[model samples]
Target: MRFSISSDRLKEALSKVSAVVPSKTTLPILQDILFELKGNALYLTATDLEISVRMTIEPVDGEEDGAGAIPEDKLTSVVKALPEGLLLKFESLDSNRVLITTNKGGEYKMSIEPADSFPAIPESIGETAGFGVVISGGVLKEIIENTVFATSKEELRPATMGVLFQFKGDEFIAVATDGYRLVKIARRGVVNLKGGADFSGVIVPAKTLQIIAKSIEDEETCEIMINEKHIQFSTERITIISRLIDEKYPNYESVIPYENNKELVVERDLFLSTVKRVSIFANSTTNQIKFKLDPSGFVEVSAEDVDFGGSAKERLDCAYNSEPMEIAFNAKFITDILGHIDSEKVLFKFGSPTRAAIVQPYEDSEDREMLMLVMPMRLNA
Candidate 1:
């Protein structure tokens, strides 16, 4: 088959789905993108077995319909380097070679493989009808941004390596935890698809959500479908199908402390900067940073590395209403929580230095809520 499309447009579509293609796969064909020309549209698909993304783009000019697998790196490199707005010609030649020619007389050829070599996109399990939910892209992006950072990288506990999506009534919560830090984002008044209200929970890999977040545009709404094993996200330009983590997420709510009576409100930027600066001197092994909350609205932050004879300290004014207290925390953990807060000010609720502390945005929104919990470290001093 032969087809012609804009180089820039083709590059953009390929980039969107290319993240699913593993750089090095046991099956060499997995490194190539499956391309097919059907009717007036050109379809592109990429997969790593566990996750697949397919995109359809209509060609500006075309001839016969055809399908083949083109080396992803070759196609992406040539298209991206070509001058924008140039029409690119793709034609299948003898001996499984595909010729890519530019409008300016530039030509390139690469070997292709049968499109059938690509694995088929998975379908929902038999006897199980799928359920779906309709949510705005912006809202979905917010949920991922708030929680994905806390997902565990450990492979042994596969559940903790993904973000948990739990649906209850009209609200849905997204939770992620790496054992040391937990992030939960709750959104209310979401529209549930037909037969979707009864759906309980699903764990989505953090990598999948990260790709979805990058592909979606603001103000766009996407349809999310979940079955027993596979979850799908469909938007205007692309559709992503990924296997669910297939593991039960921990009962994260139980771990949150209820007796965080002490509250300290501090400027988010100031606190974040202080933690980052002080962390440079923290022991590389423990990353321990000390926080001394004063009743006079000042917080003393200090860190020391006995091994390297390095030390750092800073004091910042804060709004503290609770009793005087001192807490020790991993400096990296403190900065991570502070970085995710969008508000100008953040509130920290603490019951004791040994208990998990909750961090929240000082300003509350009606439709959404975000809470982060960080486990403290033991002070060396």
Candidate 2:
């Protein structure tokens, strides 16, 4: 079997799916990319059992139709090493190896595995059990970017390690939390549910969304098909399929405090920079930063490290309408929340020094609403 494809095109398709390839796994075949020629297109697939990505590349020329599994790293390295736009000829040396020769006389051989040995990607959610929605690539990108960082890294609570996608009526909500902090973004009229149906919140692993964020471009809309067990996202050239987390996500609404009466409006950049600087003096273990709001329209941010005898404090101008209050929070958590805000000013609503606070973008978008929560730490008495 033989075919010809451009070096650049091959590299691009390979790079997109390369993230799914396991660097070291007991399953050696999972390290290879299944390459198959169907008509004028070459199909490439890579997976690590839980998530799989398959991409199609249109070839420049072909002599025969065949399929084989090429070691991803070897194939990617060789193609990338060649000059871009160079046409490369591929010929099967048998079922176990492939010979790759560049049009300019460069050559390399890679060991191949029978394509059949690659594990089968899960079939799309069955029509009877699954439903589908269409959302823009840009919206999906923003949703993942805003929420992924808040997912829990510890495996003890598997549900919090993924982002929750809740679809109901004409609204879609994406949420992620690590117990200490939570980020939630909701969009209206973004989801077109199949058969006018609704889905309870579904937990999708953060790793899967990370791959989608990289693979999906600025296409107008991507179709998302989901069911109780599996979910798939598809565009023109790429499709991603992964198993949904089976555990139930926590009822996040119940924990969101309803009595946040104190509101503080401050410049986002100024507050972020102050937190960044004061955090340097915070205890490395606690990363605690204190917020002191006074009736004089002044807010003080401070941190102290008793172990190293280091401390820092700074006061900034703000619009404080609520009563005087002081609160303690993890500096890193506050900084991260502020980083995701796109507005010039941020509104922080606090219930008390001991209750969780809500942060919102002061200037709003017409279509989307974002809310963030950070738990307060105990103040040093």
Candidate 3:
């Protein structure tokens, strides 16, 4: 089978689809992008069994239609290297090989797998009043950006490795925690069904959702459909389907305490900078930095590693009440969550020395989003 396609257009489309290819896979086909030509479009697809991406490119030039799978990265590189703005056409030499040529000059003959050898890709999702949510691209992107860092890299608790969505009537809540800290964000207009209300216990891997977040264009909103095992995201031209992490999310509810007494408020930028500076000298193993609150409303960020002749300390104006307190935390965790919070000042609360102090924007919280929680560190005993 043969097809003539525009060089620039083909490169742009193939580049998007090939990003899903696994760098190494036991099945060679999993390392390649499948190209299927039908009617007036070029269908480029790549998958790693668990995650799959299929992108379609509208056709061009004299073309005969066919399907084939070629080395994902190699094919992408060849198309990218073709002299800019040239037209590309490809034809299958046999069931297992293809020849690529361009109008302005450049050619490639590559071996590939039969289209039939490709693994099963997700099909168009069936409608069943499926669990759905819609939010602006900007909102979704920012929400994940702010919370994904809180997800666990350790897969011991698979649920902690993904973001959880809890639908509560007219609103929805998103929570993420890595056993170190937790972040909760809320969005409005979550449809809650009646009669025990349909709920989706879907946890999306932070990394996969990130890719889908990036693919969303400048559109106002996108639709999300959740099945028991898979979730589908659709934009105007782009569609992303991912297998949901099927694990029980921890009772995040239990981890969040109902009462905490001590509180400290500091300018967000000032606190972020001071923490960043003090972190430079933290222990390599723990990356622990200490915070000292004074009765006079001052917070000092400090860290020291005697082995490396490293130490740093900075102070910032803040709000403090009750007994003065000192706490330590993983510097990286502090900086990561701080970077996502968008407020002028942040509130830090402490229940006691052993508990993590909750960090949150100290502004007029017009809505009810939960506070970001961080577990305290153990200082020298």
Which is the leading candidate under lDDT? 2
Residue-level error in angstroms, candidate 1, position 292: 0.5
- The model with the greater lDDT, 1 or 2, is 2
Tell me the lDDT of candidate 3. 0.77
How do the residues 208-292 of candidate 1 rate in per-residue lDDT, one tens digit apiece?
9999998887788888888888888887777888889989889998999867878899999999999999999999989999999
The Cα local distance difference test for each model comes to 0.87, 0.89, 0.77
On TM-score, the stronger of 2 and 3 is: 2
Worst 10 residues of 3 by lDDT: 189-198
Clash number for each model: 0, 0, 1
* Candidate 3 displacement at residue 276 in angstroms: 1.6
Which 10 consecutive residues of model 1 have the lowest summed lDDT?
Answer: 122-131
User: Per-residue lDDT of 266-303 in model 2, one digit per residue for the tens?
Assistant: 99999999999999999999999999998689999999
Model 2 TM-score on a 0 to 1 scale: 0.96
Cα deviation of 322, candidate 1, in Å = 2.0
